[model samples]
Target: MSIQVGDRLPEVVLKRIHEGIESVDTRALFDGRKAVLFAVPGAFTPTCSEKHLPGFVEHFQQFRDKGIEVACMAVNDPFVMQAWAKSQHVPEGMMMLSDGNGDFTRALGLELDASAYGMGLRSKRFALYAEDGVVKQLHVEAPGEYKVSSAEYLLESL
Candidate 1:
């Protein structure tokens, strides 16, 4: 089953590209933190570009002011995620993570088989609010839908 409120995230090492690629364990990252962990199907796709990512980038500070760490995840490789983040001007407070092998996404049961779209093994668009590694709220979009997981929606929930 997919993750639900009160569920602690599964253990997985996600990649973050900096001067070089580095792996961050999800359990470690979420420990003792209230974080908004969001996933996109792919970086630079239309919705992710125009709405999803920009929403988070724009509201990152508000989240931080509320004592929440914000992170964005994609099924793309670390390089692509880094490049996309630069192009979008993702703030320092927001993390850009890559689930390159789909391990984290699959582990969350949110993997999307996008072979029909030629993207392959992407993540579904979703956002979850986690407190000290336990899920507090989860906003998972229906296929092709965009209403639930946006930053505005998540902010309202918070």
Candidate 2:
């Protein structure tokens, strides 16, 4: 089953373009802070590029104002995540995490198989709120649908 409210996030290493593809530990990122980690199946796909990530980019300050740090996760490499951040005009302080090998995705039980579409292992579209390492709220989208995971919806929920 997927990670639920009250579950402590599994420890994993994710990559980001901080001075050139730094590896970050999940515990260090989430522990002792309020954070929202939202995942997309793949970077630059239509829905994810046009709407999902942009919503977060547009609302990044709002989330920060509430004392919650935001991070966007995808199954792409750190390079792609970096490029996407640039393309989206993502502001600083919002993390663009690269799952790279889907290890973290599988640990959370949120892995998506897209072999038929030529993409292999990926993450399902989802967003989760956590406080000090434990999940407080999670909104995972139904396949081929989008709603609860949007930044606007998550802001309203908070």
- Measured by TM-score, the strongest candidate is 2
Q: Name the regions of candidate 2 deviating beyond 4 angstroms.
A: none
Q: Give the TM-score of candidate 1.
A: 0.98
Clashes of 1: 0
lDDT of 2 by residue, 7-45 (tens): 999999999989987999999999999999999998999
Q: Could you tell me how far off, in angstroms, the CA of residue 104 lies in candidate 1 after the best superposition?
A: 0.6
Q: What is the C-alpha RMSD of each candidate to the true structure, in Å?
A: 0.7, 0.5
Q: Name the top lDDT candidate.
A: 2
Cα-based lDDT at residue 67, candidate 1:
98
